[model samples]
Target: MSRLTELLSRIKAKDPKIGNELAKEIKVLSARRQFGLNFERHKPENVELANREVRRGDKIRVLPQRGSTKNSDKRLWQVKDTFKKKNDHLATIELLGHDVAETQVVKVEDLIVVAEFQDSIYPGLISTGKVEKGKDKPYNTVINGENYHALKALTFTHKGKIDAIYIDPPYNTGAKDWKYNNDYVESDDHYRHSKWLAFMERRLVFAKKLLNPSCSVLIVTIDEKEINRLGLLLEQSFPEAQIQMISSVINPKGTGRALFSRTDEYIYYVFIGSAKVPDKVGKGEEKEVRWRYLRRTDDESARGTKKGGPAQFYPIYVNKNTHKIEVIGEPLKPEDDISKIKNINGCVAVFPIREKDEHHMNWGLTKPSLEKALSKGFVRVSRKEDSQIQPYVFSYLTAPNIKKIDNGILYKKGQREDGSWIVVDPSGKSSRPTTNWNEKSHEAGAYGTSLLKALIGKRKFPFPKSLYAVEDALRIVVGENKEAKVLDFFSGSGTTAHAVMRLNRQDNGERQCISITNNEVSADEQKALIKKGFRAGDPEWEKWGICDYITKPRIEAAITGVTPQGKPIEGEYKFNDEFPISDGFNENAEFFTLSYHTPLAVNHNLAFKQIAPLLWMKAGSRGKRIQELPERGWEVADSYALLVDLDKSSEFIKPVKASKSITMVFIVTNDDRRFQAIVRQLPESVEPVRLYESYLKNFQFTIE
Candidate 1:
């Protein structure tokens, strides 16, 4: 039977009407453009790799085509020629879709042929962060690239290796906080949520491939704006995994500012395989802390000196010379004639300021209580103005003090002592975190914002995740995986990296964290640059991006034990319960920018030097040899080797087989027949990976 007849017969068996309609559609398209079916192999929609070879008439798609850009707009090219010239490592392609016959030499990594093996690996990971010369970097990685493409590249490098993925994506609140494609996805745009989900779906699909199927975690954080949709998305994506949500309070006191205040956010986690979630038990919260109220409240009105409590209200005397409490005076107990009782001699009396009448309210302490507080060094006083001083109560101003609890829930073991607030249960014990988190450490204002500002000297990025929060999250989910591979694609302000460093310092665990963020400039900043005759991809535009300006620098500071201003971090960072956090968990991490390299020569010809770094990264970036040794016949280390010269294959295979250290071998040859023959002869212990087959097949669009 004819090809058309055979195709129609097969289609008719499935659906007669659809087959008839498809036949017509094929006829019309056949007349307009020729597509090579010979080189195409039948593939399922779920398959990620295309066919292994390119044919004369195969359709090709150019990726990353910016809609309004001059280049990349012309798509749907066709292959006019497919032949190996100098080597099989690369094949040449002549485009029939465009007015060119192999004029623009293409990268096999750049183009995707229709109905072909869908696999595409990116080029070398260009080093972006500063690394010490001659140092072998086998630690974490931070990638500044578009996430979808980055995730796809990771599939080639990190397949089945990732242990954790924690992403805090844009909430899609129509706040223009994120950009989709080249445009800012705003709230007014219809289908904004759909666009966000679609964008997430594509990346998530590849993210799953990078994760260890047997044991891994996929965590996504969102606010009320997208929690429901994200929850559904997580369910659809990870159907077999156990999914759970943890509501964490971030801004609890949205009380008077807004209705139904957004005090909390959600963390949706999907644990796959044997992945386990352990409660954080040894955290400093278990270390007993003296929780104290800085202000004294009258029991009747539940206000500080609001009305009526007399005996407990009195002034404490401060020495004007030393700014220290010198005397505790008696109170005017509603019956004490003020003229009869002399004020404490040689001291100035300071009274507590009531909110309703702060200037006139009496101080909140009996003479005995004040005396005890002074002895315990718990009585703190602050004066703001320089010349004429007026002292205000300074409770809860430091870690030693706590929030006054008259209007709030008094925490476990929370109570008033002789004069200061202290936990009733002085013994510290680890407690499981509840759904409602009002801990002082959880408060973003103090721990997240202020702490970051103190460390960095400026708050360049808004709403950074608290370092403690991320640390605790990892501690809970990661459990005892000492060298866990943690991934955070949305690495805002590098908090995850900071937490990883901190966690490693605490446990001496060599956990590696990969942080990826697109170096996209803010919308307003981009617009301003555009007004100044600047456009995207410009130097100025990159300077405004969150990744380059905030995340990268912040991460560098955190790892190098320096402040963002380049100052060495000094002194200890201690929690309220006296848990001393390491000031500088000094560690090393390599930063990479996702980039593409054009093919210098064709016939599936990849420049071996250019593709070397990519191969090394695929081997977990753990190779001890950063460079090829002089006079060496092959490129190698313990974990992996890239064979550039086939002549040395016999010599290379001998050592690899004997040592049993090398597991992945890459031989650079385009001859599939030769490759297979060599593979059959190889030791069963090592896996044979082709050097540039998919890459060579990808960039073809030749027309016969």
Candidate 2:
């Protein structure tokens, strides 16, 4: 036993009551000291709350004086009164939490609101702008706020639903790249690593909650500075997760150093539950036979009319006895009834109708393309024992499969009697991925910095992630899902969302992404702003922040396929899914700023507009979000049904039950029994959620 344990035992014998309180402290201390990878776990991380007017009883911190290099006063104070003094706005404040008789007058612009750990904050989101390039696609969200509080708000909307989380947090290189508790943790700080650990641990704790417990993965990228400590923290935070680290060479020409030149960074993948690494055929890696379902599942799979339809929306005649695709039919016209299509010569005419009937989805290949692929022995068909609507399932070799064969990547094992080829992938020969990942596309300087420059036309941010590197990492986890929900809380420069957009364009997938970042100005820019007359929360100063000037602009440019100057992007994306950057992407994204609200406003239902978007996100983010409260008792969107007035439950029930696609039903009622009764009357397929209970109770029980 350690000293604390032995001391606790002795103290308990002397004084039971005193020992009990001491034990609590000892337990906390022991948790930090006894661990192999220990740090100051309880260190509180404070956030400089922004964009709020100073009010009575509000906590505030005095901003450092202009031309001053350091913050001299770190005390927290409460606002007592505010009044205009001549041409200046001044506030009367006293030191918070202490019985002080003294009060001081300070310029309002010189003070900023502050929130400490465990402070109850009512978080809301206000839309800054939106970039819409497609309909029937979920909106990718970008939130500008401190990630910790943002993650807290996400718990209500995305808890246990995120498929993959990719974060590239500050490396804590002591270059003043990151801040802790409103102060930059420079190299000389004695508790630098400790503070970094505390910061990471708090966010990781919330990250674990946001991930899907059944199958999801967390991907974190860092350099040598904190890789080891990060690994230990990941293990400690997610003891049940399967954690592995990969060394990836990002820069071929290493950074100059006193001893060894650093050339690579590490990526940690923490797999929870049934999540597993993907099997992929690549150069210098094992290759294997791969056959994917021919039916498409993404939003682009929907059936279209002849005037504007997918050419892949044709039929295949499959012989029932031989289970062989015999003939490929021509593309369907708008007037051609699918029911009128008949079997040909003892064969079944199979269209790409989906199972469980989500939509009349299109096939992955067009009629002519399917015919060519089939002649090359790259197609096969099978049927389940009791499959209906979709009587037969078709499988085919994809582009990667054909490319491997043509490039001699996979060796042919043998040939089957039915004119099919057997192939084996030589790389790894196992589903598990290798620990070392070195690829040309993973080069940050080329694909990351250079590609971003080509798109946005400037290096507005530092050390942004390589677009391909993030795409490959996410592909390993949720690529097959197609409609995966990905989150990146530390979304610097918006690379993660850009990667997701690229991935979707590659396969016509509908994967949605949510990225969060703070609008922090660089140290140099901060000094320059302070030299002027601007303070921290001033609009003039915040306009130059990373989110406003870089992240938001970068994401908008990527989605719209244009630069900030409205010129078409002039480069082509490289590797696996290559496309001209000018082609743009069929996607939509909304930029939001995290807004704090008063508890009184939220409880009184005065913040419905602010809360509506979150409710849309909770209901799978499908279809257009309802921004306003409906005057009618109920409103039914494409994917979700909302009942604002409880008295109209009877009118709401019929339409909600009639709609086959609605997945979420939100009822506005405070009565538990009434909510349960209404829920019981709804369809089993619909997830019934109580509006106030789901939203308010979660915040009231907010974890610090």
Candidate 3:
């Protein structure tokens, strides 16, 4: 059969729905030949060796170090001159020893060379808190870079250190909210998917390398829009890993729309290797009840039956000292003619017994243990009569431990009487937790609904997770180690951090949290700015721009222990910016000054040294002067040139008089007709001035 026919037959036999979908997609793809669907692989450049043969001292320069601009430009010239002059001096000294009558000498091969790798490494360590007495505490460090770059650096050293990772990356919804290479990529872009895919693929590859063998990653996402695609990505990236889905019901109240309410979000659980749930014992375990108690009305009535008159007629004696009921010997048996039983409220049938069988007693202690009754001066004895005797029965209330009561039935209204909150007794026995979950029960206090309210507060981070929910999840993963490092890169409003703080305070566990959040400003700030009568691009209020209103304020709020509105709150954290540098240079040459007017080469170096100074000579400054050369004497009139020969050789005599001179000019204003006239009137013998554009612009010069 043909390939098309075979494919059609297989599609018809397997899945009609998927086959139809694939057919439609194929048709669409055929119509759009230039849809730009393609696959590409990225490989790092390899260090090449001569003749493909390895040799000693053949070091590969994978990544070059960044140098500082503090004194970099000054040192650059110094280094070039030093190496070149040293070679010249050595050749000159050697030439002087010779008996040759040559007036001047030159070394053909001597030239200044710049070292390929002449830069410094940035040596900055980020610390989360204070250290003391030889103890090293792990600090939460923030890395700022493009996704792949940051991931690569982190993976280089942090492999096998992370226990859990949570990421909430860009959703790629086509809005200008997402940025790639410092510019926002619009939704309608042709290669949107490819761009996002490439971005995520690089980071995910490195992120996988950073995870420990048993570590897990939880990715929060919405719908199945990218689920299948992400699943395929994960399969290719981590072939041995397994992917599971956890759905959380976020919204229950519908918007009363035409379709079903969008209430749930999914979390993709990706485990690097074998994943195990941590063991956790819920709180208030000591107060929980194991079993319940029921009244013994049937046993009470049976014991009363042995009495001659009525079962309820038996008298139960109470011990005043111990508050325990005292059990006496068997009661006297009634005669057959005198056994006229009366049915009372607590009465039952009577038992007949012979008086001579008093020594052979069958009744045992009812309320107390056998040993306890004996120790309390009780003996087994039977009352005797000529006809029959009735046995005495004692009544006692058997209660169970109140703490051990199950939360199932007791959670309902009116389970117990008004005076009794619990049906079971409270005699020292504790209870175990039940499978039934009660939101309002005492056992639920550790993970109560109240915790959810505290975390979210007034700032509604949509679908904010309940604190109890997170704590319960952590308990399963943390096990007995109270110092587990938890990371939540998608931390919205710092809920996870709050939960960690609360858990530590309650359990005294020293759990640490690393939370990351984009500095998106809240809605309230936009409203407040409009209300404050601010307009866009107003010079007086230009600093209050959109970017400033958003990222800066939100981060400040998080670090300063203040609400989005700047209200003070307890438990503030000190935050500092962490700048990471490439690991290829020495410490001194990693920072440089940045500017637009400077050459791109200089600016690239400036990124390493942010505060390096720039040296500029203003035009018309007083300095060394050169005598005017005749215009007719110049070989090139339009272009100016000068040569300096320090040896003053007789073999190379200059045709014109040479003098050391430096030219400079400064424009006072753009429309300075006087300066233009002066330039035109300059003698033809003078060299044409080479003015710096920046200096001219700085003086506000205009061509007249």
- Which parts of model 2 are misplaced by more than 4 Å? 1-25, 32-35, 64-72, 83-90, 97-99, 282-432, 702-704
lDDT of 1 at 59: 55
Q: Who is ahead in lDDT, 2 or 3?
A: 2
**Candidate 2 residue pairs in backbone clash:** 285-427, 286-426, 286-427, 286-428, 287-425, 287-426, 287-427, 288-425
Candidate 2 lDDT tens digits, 1-704 = 58777887898999886697677656666567455687875547778876877777788888778767665477889899999989999999998656656679999988888877767777889899999875888889999999998998999899999999999998998897999877888999989998999899889989999999999999999988898899999988999999999999999899976689988999999999999887655556644465766766544445883433668778888777877778898888645688777658888788876543335667878788788888988876666445456677777878887898889777667766545677777765445578988889999999888888987886567877789999988889988989999999998899999999988987889999999999888999888887785766788989888888888988888887778887766655777654446557889999999888777777667987888878888888777677787899789988898888888999989999999889998888778998988999999999998877778777775333
lDDT (Cα, tens digit) per residue for candidate 1, span 532-573: 755445566667777778787777666554666655533234
**lDDT (CA) for every model shown?**
0.60, 0.82, 0.34
Candidate ranking under lDDT, highest first, comes to: 2, 1, 3
Off by over 4 Å in 3: 1-147, 175-177, 185-187, 214-220, 254-259, 278-473, 490-492, 517-704
List the candidate 1 regions with Cα displacement exceeding 4 Å.
1-123, 132-137, 255-258, 279-436, 570-583, 597-610, 623-632, 654-663, 671-687, 694-704
Q: Pick the candidate with the highest TM-score.
A: 2
Which one wins by TM-score: 1 or 2?
2
Better of 1 and 3 by TM-score: 1
